[model samples]
Target: MNAPSGASGYDAVVLGGGVAGCVLAARLSEDADRSVCMVEAGPDYGAEPRHWPHKVLNARALPRDDVWERHTAVHRIRARVLGGSSCINGCWNTWGSATDHEEWVRAGGPRWSASAMERHRLRAVEQMGLRAVPERELSLWARAALEAAEELGYGHVAMAAPGRPGFGTPLINAVDGVRWNAAFAYLDAARQRPNLTILSQTTVNRLDVRTGRVRGVELDVDGRRETVVADTYLVACGTFGSPALLLRSGIGPADHLREFGIRTEVDLTGVGANLSDQPGIFVPLAPTPDLNAALAAKEASGNLYVSRMLIRAASDLCPDSSWDLHILPSAGAPLFGSLPPGQYEAGISAFLMKPASRGHVRLRSADHSEPLDIDPAFSTDPDGHDIAVLRSGLEIVERMAVSAALKPLAGAAQGHPSRDLSDEEIRSRLGAYWHPVGTCAMGQDDDPWAVVDEEARVRGVSNLRVVDASILPTVPAANTQLPVLTVAEMLADALRTDGR
Candidate 1:
């Protein structure tokens, strides 16, 4: 753990160094008049080996240099560093559609209108210096996938070009082709501000609430207890951590918190509710005998492109109803859980989009140091739309395999060569897509269960706010990196206006 060796005081404290947390600190300190403090429980990503762009050459799992590992009946991975998960995730970026924000507004999160979010989205791209890629300039595989879709009569997809939806190459948070995490984009710049102080390796054990208002927080610093006080504090600790913090502070489903002997500070039953994420239905393909030479292409020349293909299938198969299919070209050697060597050395993988089922993040115990229970509630919802989409994705991939463009490279299917794979078979094989969201939601009205309001202020509490993925009312149809960054940018400006 990277501990801060100094005492600090600031007008506000931004907890968690992920995309939202870093942005909160950076944006708040922009005026140079107010002081801000940002703390992360993880190590620094700058000195880590896994963060190297070229390190992709190594097929082995990146070493857990700066991340923290927690054990339970189920194993989970978390980055305990200045950059949070951004330090360890693959550089796949996705921005939400306009409809995404409209839904939020409808869900009671005012000021979250699609147009409002677009303003922030533009600022986020400018902050990161991201240039839009022309669809025609996309790599061969990407072009082929697009072409294949057209041939199969599913042609309305877009590329990574600006202002397009459905299928476009992702806009990575990579600077100069290297991963550009939140700490790099916002926090690192904020660290240079004289009024901003960053305390690393410090974990907040609980919030110190007094008289139904937030006073400060309690911390477990290197196994020692410490109390922190500030005029205002923000919990950017993420969906899982944010709710867990509330539970430890005696806020949550009343009965659940009481069982642990922690008196309820606020009975917010929705604290850990509305959890969700996207899962995939993978389709493996091998290069044709002629393209074996292409399989040996240099690492520098190979890149993976992720785009979605909306599939219309039986609604009965999927109840929650929203779904999309992901397409990625096989770059080189086999990935985790590879099959026999002769398998198509290069191919495409697909995933179900906009899953309908929801999951929950809950406390296994009230102990701050204990790991929180995570059900991710995957596929438990019978009303979910992903089950149908997964089956549809299987059929679509099979259709592409037979297309003139993909057929030459993918060849005739083997084993079950009849393009007749079952939905159950697809479900059995595909895995989660890694876009988890919406544990700590923000809304208006009398919903005490909502942790925060439209302006990002924590409900029932003053001088505190939450600026992270947890506040997302609905997960976007695409990647979350861009949206998370946008939220940070917007909040930064909002905080400035509020402070004035």
Candidate 2:
């Protein structure tokens, strides 16, 4: 490994080159006075073989040596690149609503209200060049299904604020039919700054903390061990990586850290607790005789936005809820398996956004080389509210399937063949989207599990912070990418406001 000639230590070191890390690296280096170093355990975005826009094509194809093709779980998708999941995720963006941030505040995120979140969202969209465009009517299957949902009391939600609902939501990360991931939005700009340096394909094993202060880091690069010293450090390695790294570094619960023969830095019990993810349901649509020709004509053109249903989870069986509906214009290739050809396959996916169940992440071995246990403990929500919401979602599917506009596209229902099945059967096939949140939670000192404070500073530790989705006490009602970026944006503003 070759190090830069003058490279030594940086003013700030950002672990993980994912969306949040990229934003922080860019924003912190804006002043040019502070030197920022962003380290990614993945490959550079340009060299990665598979890209976000071509995910469908890759889905049909098998995996190769592409850095974007790393699977975090047995049957899940993860991208290990400079842009992290943004380099390989579906190009759909869900800018969370004001209520989402309000929920965050209630959950213990400090100094972050719904209004503050809105300002950050606006700034993010403006930077991404998300312009509203007219919806093209070529995809009849999607159009028909959306129309059916409307008739059944589910209206289209404009991804924009100000309460004007419409059919299309602007694609923030997609510019002129190309994928514009976080690498392009933040990391690319940061690369030009002399003070900002990015190191890729390096995995951080642990931290070097002395007297409750972060001093440096220990890393493994190409089968070699190296050390890096930094004045301040921030961990933005998403939900899993951050907590696992902290745990491996003996910065978690004192008892847990002791079992691994590592001395404890802090007894942060909530370092890897309160994990949550949304469940998903896909309803397919049939095609008309002219569907092929019509789709071909409008190829490279699409609504590219989600027309979602802000429905609740289930009956009030649980304090929290599960399963919110997302009426996307089109579905990506089947997440679970293959779909039969010649079917007009438009879909409405219902995600269990407000799930009552919770899970946690832990290290199976003290070894940093081993994969962490994801222990989602999914489908075990005590109230069974997730099942109930999905059942309601299934009823919605049935209603839309039989609608005047949708029946033509949905030639026949498969499961029950002649009739819709009972709620029990629908619950059987429901699954989850891979949006994980809340492992290293944020809260006040009064909170038993609070790992960091409102300003993202690690409690009991100086010059060490966590600036990622891991700090979210609870998952929001929308996709995590947008919210995570918004968190970084707000933090950046706070840092600037403090002149630190």
Candidate 3:
């Protein structure tokens, strides 16, 4: 369906039709009295599964070729679609631990505590159709991994269920081979509502602010410049995009904005600081003959090659807290990237779920068309805390590889350049799991770097809020899709209660 002409005067304008944007648009529009508009920079295939691209619908391989790439090796992927990264991500549905939200409460307030966020989590789970791929349907490789973990005494643990933590098959937001992205799960049901308008292929240049109040947004629609007026404006453009939008709107650090010749609206130093991601390293293992044969047979049966098993555990760094490491295995090596033909290989991708290192996203120019400078600063913590956690995770992977259950299926370990390496060598191999957060962190008023408040309202600005991974003061201990959805749900609930 074509977007309505002359888009203007919406009760709430949600920029970036990503996971959070979709949730906010749907929930806010439910009032029937409020008018909502969702704008996406990429193509929106409407609400039909048939309309979606085959690459996007497939829940097996991630569509990384279609994403926007940054210069950094650790933080490179960003999907520009209606569902955002949810449309092109590994379908791992992990809610993390209750402690993750507790940390948020400590940073923000009581409203962000674990108990307060539970309702939203339940709502997201039901709405997204999150469930485990039955053991009957598990790939041979995934089953073997689960068996191996069990042999090592980790036992079967449900990662998707709330507050339950142990080693188990990871649940996914996939049903019957189709990836149930946020757009399909949330926005589809609300698209028909006359109060909601979805504008595809529309890029938001910046928000229009006057005297500390946001009046509307300036957009580049179909090569034509236009202004979209709204009482409230929400930036749900993920971690990088949200901060970039704020910076372009002259609402970031004063020195940075003045350097670009743009007038400063809000001198918020924390607009793009405090970036964090899950630092990870992949250990490739040559598959034994028996495992190789099983993989071939499984592939011939037309089953997905990806593994669903994930092991979450805490390292010695945080023994008292919840799990801080995620050990994920893949059936085939080529599933992630190119490999030698006929070489059957699987890899253990382990990440430090709670990283200590922080990074930042800054504007290269005032132009909206230019990409922002994203530096995740992987393993760069001053106290060497990030590297310590990552090294411990690697040690766990090594143990898993040499375990009795996996001995029959595992062969020699393959490392980058060579198999033998020092601690520093391993640290150099550190990469990211592509989960970036905390760029536009929400904190109390006294905090100098806090960009938003507990209510998600942008600091020093009226009628403008940020609702995405950017507002997360810290990254969650699991895949960010569920947490981002839950946060958006909580924000929507708050907005509803405010009666705005």
Best-matching candidate per lDDT: 3
Give the root-mean-square deviation of each candidate in angstroms: 4.2, 4.2, 2.1
- Mind giving the per-residue lDDT tens digits that candidate 2 earns over 202-231? 888888777899777887777777777777
Q: What is the number of backbone collisions in each predicted candidate, taken in the order shown?
A: 16, 3, 1
The 10 consecutive residues of candidate 2 with the worst lDDT sum are 56-65
Query: Candidate 2 regions off by >4 Å?
Result: 1-7, 46-76, 97-99, 107-110, 160-170, 284-323, 327-346, 417-428
Superposition error at 130 for model 1 (Å): 2.2
- Ranking of models by lDDT: 3, 2, 1
Which of candidates 2 and 3 is the stronger one according to lDDT?
3
Model 3: per-residue Cα lDDT over 1-500, one tens digit each: 33445647988989998899999999999999999999998888878999888889888677764466634353668988898888988877787777777778877899887777878888998998888777655766787778778776775666765554468866688777788899999988898999998988888898877789987788887778888898888899989999999999989999999989978988999999999998788787878777877777766665655677888877787646478899887776475457564456687877888888899999999888887798888888889887777767777787777777676787656444223456577677776787899999998888998999998999888899999999999888888988898899999999999865
For candidate 3, the 10 contiguous residues with the lowest summed lDDT are 412-421
Cα TM-score of candidate 3: 0.95
* Candidate 3, pairs of clashing residues: 157-167
Error of 2 at 358 (Å): 0.6
